[model samples]
Target chain A: MRIAFAGNPNSGKTTMYNALTGRSEKVGNWGGVTVGSKEYPIKEEYTGGKEVVAVDLPGAYSMSPFTPEEGITSEYVRTANPDAIVNIVDATNLSRSLFFTTQLLELGIPVVVALNKSDINEKEGTKIDVKKLSEKLKCPVFETTSTEGKGLKDVISNAIELVGGGQSAPYVQADINLQNKAEVDAEDRKRFSFVNDIVANVEKREMLSSETTKSDKLDGVLTNPIAGILVFAAVMWAVFWVSQAWLGPLVADWLVGWIETFQEWVAGKLENSPAILSALLADGIVGGVGAVVGFLPLVMVMYFLIALLEDCGYMARVSAVMDPIFKRVGLSGKSVIPVVIGTGCGIPAIMACRTIRDERERRATSMLATFIPCGAKIPVIALFAGAFFAGAGWVSTLSYFFGLLLIFLGALLIKYITGYKYRKSFFIMELPKWKMPSLKFAFKSMMERAKAYIIKAATIILICNTVVQIMQTFDWHFNVVEEGAENTSILASIASPFAILLIPLGFGVWQLAAAAITGFIAKENVVGTLAVVYGLTAFIDVDELEMTGGANNVAMATGLTSVTALAYLFFNLYTPPCFAAIGAMNSEMKSRAWLWGAIGLQLGTGYTVAFLIHQFGTLFTEGHFGNAFIPGLIAVAIMATAVILIGRKTRAHFDEKYRLHRDGKSGAAA
Target chain B: MLLNAEPGKTYTVKEINTDDEEMNSFLFRLGCYVGEPITLISKKKKSCIVAIKDGRYNLDELLSSAIIV
Candidate 1:
């Protein structure tokens, strides 16, 4: 039997599904976190070993879908013949949530309404007469706290028992012309009145929502236009500083020591083996994977902090705070969610844009959100920052700030190029009550993300490192390249041409080019490939580097000055994300033109940003632009011209659209 | 009047003036419609926090202005 979990947004449907199914799907305080339907078998404990599948659908307000994700829910419930429905309603907001509940009850599916967030209601001195509510709605109602795993078993068991028993709606709309807007509106008003009547009878509240509360006071400080932006900046900077500089490196040193010891043990075991075999197993695979995994502490810590932020309901406030500023650039404040989520991973971030009502804004957000460097790129940032800048905290902090700057600039550029005219776009976001962020949930989220990071390091990064190891070991004639003749190796020969194109960016060597190329497969591959090619693995521990003639030796091997290194880091950060994230962008944008334009914009931004940094840095330090300045200038000029041409065409199209309006008005004026 | 209403004051919504049909319908679902009591919880330079039914929502200037009290 398949049971559908439906509810209003943020009413804990996904949270309940995760608890029942033992799956860690994303759960945030904000609405529209789950954009698609997900299903898994219920845990044995919950079902008592019954063969039941729980379908977790996105939250919907009513049968008539308003947003894109809400449509997913309404469509599934209406068409998909589920045996039972579990409507998870926010208990505190009973008056508003049951507006959708009545609609769900009318669907004729056996609905067992799970009044979720009952703990909140209990704290606020709100009481609901569950028996009366159930009697009135003609369904079984059980109080539940999905976050605490309370009342879940009863809800599921009740739902399972009613699998074949059909539902009977208490209040049904009279037959009317569904196509007539006025008729539908009138019917909806009646349905709401019915829900209101039921709520007034069953729900007793001690505190009215209209009264000012402590959270409201916090909002006054955190959501103030000036103070909020500064607080946001400070919070982000602290997240990076703690993760990258203070706590992360302290933990990473210990982890790297263990990794080095393990690598040494493996090398000792392979001492009697053939040179190629030993190098392949010990130095190539373990060394490369270890290099990538050494940054796990940083990634995990950042994930934990972000999860706490997401759990505490700050994201919705952040969106509300940013909406006014974002509106100026043809995007909504809701776009900020995707960009912040993009910091962890771009795939879900792009998908998160589904909540935005405007199609153009949604697509534009999906295309640009990846500018915020994700977890995969952290290793690269750490590696470069440590090697070139002595692990300065400002390096990582500056990268994130630069990313935000680019997002703003990119939005403005897109606004002009798309010929967007300022129209009145209304912004409304629910203010979910703030609570103490759950530490256990943040720990679980961090562990889930860390596990994924390690698996990728073992699988894709491991495979890429091995391939690079073999390719660099052999020549075109299928013979191992002679020592001191590494330039003739297969990998070197292929990467040489790409190196020439990067000459103007100051780092033109085939090794840097090779790392950049492999970066496309997975951003972590940049660090892995660099470790393999350089035969160095202690990128995190300063003590190890000191014994090996210090960080300057690693920097010297890469043959890049601090200026060029910063340029290269920015290049990798701003360019299009890994192909997997690009596929996500493709799916979210749902337009070939937008996808191609996104890629073009990313590439241009990466190159132009890097070129300016390297050239200007060299000019400031060495009194001249770096080599290949003229060619880089021509390339940037060509990109600039293309942008201008596209903008002009868009403007022409805009004028043409308005010209028709003027033509119609010409008659009135005459 | 929602645009200029003092904080902590309740006013009944008389109309939603936007020509956008979708916006009107969405507001209706949130229980922000004619005759519903709406409270102006707080006001900002560009947006206002409003309490409708049992939920608190932050609405921008344009949206709050459209909701005539």
Candidate 2:
């Protein structure tokens, strides 16, 4: 038997589902966290040994969906014939929740109501007559606290028993013309009144929700336009600082120490083997994988902090505060969540775009979210910063600042290209009450992400490093390439043609070109490939590199000046993310044209930014433009012409459609 | 009238004056409809926080101005 959980946004449906199924499916203290429906077998302890599957659907307010994610919920329940449904109602908001409860009951599926967050009602002196409410709605109601796993056994046990039973709605809507707007409105109004009457009879509140509370007081400061922006910036700065600069690096150093010991252990065991075998097994496999895994602590710490932030209900306030600014750029406050999540990983960030109501904004956001450098790009940034600039703090800070600038510019460019007019984009978000962020929940979330990170390292990074190691090890004739003749190797020959195109941006060597090409597979490959090709295995141990002048040696080995290094870093950061992330973008966009356009935009942006930085940085430092400046200029000018032409074409299309509408002709363009 | 409504005071919604039928219906689902009681919990320069039923929501100036109380 499959039982579906459904309810209003932020009503604790996903939380209760997680408790019963023993699976963590990204529960957050905001609406639309679970953007897709997921199913898992209910833990046997709760099911009393019956084979039952629990389906956790995205929260929705009614059968009529508002956003894409809400559509998933309504569509599943209406079409998928689940044996039972658990309607998780927010107990504190009985008046609003029962409106949905009444709608669910009308579906004729047996719904066991779990009045979640009942503990909040207890503290506030609000009371609900559960037995009376059950009698009124003709369904069993159990008070549940999902966060603490309280009353879940009863909710699941009752739902299991009620499987295959019929549900009788208390108040049924009179048959009306569904196509008529007036008729639907009249019927919905009657339903709301019915829900209100039920609430008035069975509920008592000591304090009205309209009154100002402590949460409202905090919101005043946190969501104040000016103070809110400042607070948000400070909060982000702290998250990055702790993860990248302060505590993260401290833990990474200790982990890197262990990795190095293991690497040496493997090398010692393989000492008697052939030189190539020792190199392949010890250096290519263990050393390369270790270099990537050494940065796991930083990524894990950042995920832990982000999970805490999401759990605390502050994400909604942040969205409210950012909406005004984001709106000006053709995005919304909802866009902020995806961009923030992109700082961790671009895949989930693109998935997060489903909550945005407008299709155009959602597509634009997914395209641009990866402009923020992700956790995978951290190793590349650290490599450049350590090798070229003595590990300067400004290098990383400047990278993020530039990323923000590009997001704003990218959004504006997309607006022009898509021919978006000044539509009244409304912004509204439920302000869920605040609570202390759960440490255990954050820890669990952190471990889940860490597991994903290690798996990616062992598979993609491991294979790419071995391939790069082999390509650099032999010439086209299959004999091992002698020292100083690596340029004749297969990798060098393949990357040389690409290197010619990049000469204008400086650092036109085949080795650098090879690393950048591999970046499209995985951003971490930029670091891993560089380590394999350059035979430098200590990118993560920044302190050790600095202490032994290894940074200078690494810089010398790459043959890039400081200016060119910065250009190379930006090139990798701004380009289209890994193929996995592009797959995510493809799914979210659902438009082949938009997906291709996004890739083109990212490619053009990356190339243009790198060209300008290298050319201008060289002009300032060396009193001349970088090499192949003329070719770079032509390339940039061609890209600029393409953008302008596309923008004009889209504008003409929209103008034609609107003119047809104005002239009373059929506006068939839509 | 919602834009100028006093904070912490509850008023009945007179109408939702938006031409967008979808937005109007979406608002109705949240219990913000004609003759329903709504409260202005606080107001800001660009957005206002309002309470409908037992939920508090932040609305942008454009949306807040469209609500007639």
Residue by residue across A338-428, what tens digits does model 2's lDDT show?
9887888999899999999999999999999999999898878877877788766567667776887899999999988888765779999
What lDDT is reached at residue B10 by model 1? 88
lDDT of each: 0.90, 0.89
What TM value does chain A in model 2 reach? 0.97
Candidate 1 residue spans exceeding 4 A from truth: A542-550, A651-670
Over the stretch A8-39, how does candidate 1's per-residue lDDT look in tens digits?
89999999999999999999998888999999
The most accurate candidate by lDDT is 1
Worst 10 residues of 1 chain A by lDDT: A661-670
Instruction: Provide the lDDT at A137 for model 1.
Output: 93
Worst 10 residues of 2 chain A by lDDT: A541-550
- What does DockQ give for each predicted structure? 0.84, 0.89
What is candidate 1's CA lDDT for residue A192? 88
